[model samples]
Target: MTEMLAHELRTARAPISAHLFVSGFTYTGMISSWLPDKPDAACTSEETVSHLVERLEHGDFYILCPDNEVTPEIDRKRVAWAAQDIIENRPALSRWHPDFAERFAAFEKPDRNVEKV
Candidate 1:
């Protein structure tokens, strides 16, 4: 919705470039409430903003931020799967549904869908 708004604003008003920064789990006050100590999996606020700046400078329209635990490859796969869910008309968040659990697991496996020619 934010992306759509950005697009509409750009179209209706000025020629502005919309850069959406999708952040991952960051070591912030919210996390502090859950965990006393910042986990190794979470990225610092500075790190997260740094990544955003880097991607913004690179002229990325859709920026998917990654934390210590989640790599870029995994992020891409998850995003692709989410898009597919809409395209395929599957259940909302079918990835978490018990019926699709095995399929989601298989989808997460590296090189699972690669075809050998």
Candidate 2:
């Protein structure tokens, strides 16, 4: 899944300086490895998206949307909600709607503690 997301990002010509792969949904290590620097950040989906948007506004880097149901067009509200969940250190999965959970289940994996993030 990580590889797929990375490939999509690369194909889209998004910047590679820094990127965030929202954890708690999928545990693909590719994004962590692709980052130019160590993975010093981890957050619920919302916080990650918020930071990504800030970075995008500042021209810090480009944001890549993983091929999930959360399209960028509808992600503004989702990102804000995710940001709050992350800041509170809550499990992102808990916030998903019932319909999304059904689709997201295919991507779930055992939680692996990342030593760096």
Candidate 3:
């Protein structure tokens, strides 16, 4: 996942949920390899989150959707919420709507059929 994280990013906001929306997104990958737990896991999660937060606070991720009013501040808030869930090591799986979970699962497929938003 670090490779994905390290992928060139546009001059946009934190993109906190970008990975989640992407297919094959893994929590352990966005992290640095120097944190805790088994040697196979962990990374600079703090630094990454901090940097993401900085961009998030600046409304770089601001967008409009059926569930949102398209405000930069609101986008930042949403990003913050998602980031905190990761920082606290919370299992967000149960919190996501089943529809989203299905979508994420489909992302792993070679011929994904999800439509562009």
Candidate 4:
């Protein structure tokens, strides 16, 4: 919904841009309370915010942040798969459906454990 709104606003009100900052596995008090301990893959809220600032400074319109668990490449693959879901006329979230699990796993395997320093 926000993405659609951003596009509409950008079209109607020119010269202004709306950016979306997407984060994964952020560690906060609420999240901590849900688990016995914080996971190593989760980034602290401060770290997430700092990265957001850095990306914004770099003029990134759509920022998909990398936590310890998920890297940028993996995020890109996921986004591409999501778009394919619509284009391919598959059911919503087919990636998680049992019938499509094997295919999704194959598509995601190349991205797994591939990260930058």
Highest lDDT: which candidate?
1
Off by over 4 Å in 3: 1-68, 93-117
Clash pairs for candidate 3: 32-43, 32-44, 33-43
Report the CA-based lDDT of candidate 1 relative to the real structure: 0.83
Q: Compared to the true structure, candidate 2 yields what TM-score?
A: 0.27
Worst 10 residues of 1 by lDDT: 108-117
Candidate 4 lDDT by residue in tens digits, 1-114? 758867887789966667798998899998877886879999989999999999989977788988999978778887888888898888898889998988778888764542
lDDT for predicted candidate 4 compared with the true structure = 0.82
Models 1 onward score TM values of: 0.84, 0.27, 0.26, 0.80
Q: Which ten residues in a row have the lowest lDDT in candidate 3?
A: 18-27
Candidate 2 vs candidate 3: the lDDT winner is: 2
Please give, for residues 1-117, the per-residue lDDT of candidate 3 as tens digits: 533553434334455433322111123543325433423222244433554566556654432221112233333334454554477565574226474455444442435332321
Q: 77 in model 2: Cα distance from truth in Å? A: 2.4
Question: Which lDDT tens digits does candidate 2 get at residues 40-74?
Answer: 33334565566567766775433544333444433
Which candidate wins on TM-score? 1
TM-score of 3: 0.26
Instruction: For residue 101, give model 3's deviation from the true position in Å.
Output: 20
Candidate 4 segments whose C-alpha is farther than 4 A from its true place? 4-16, 111-117
lDDT score of residue 12 within candidate 2: 88
Clashing residue pair totals per candidate (backbone < 3 A): 0, 4, 3, 0
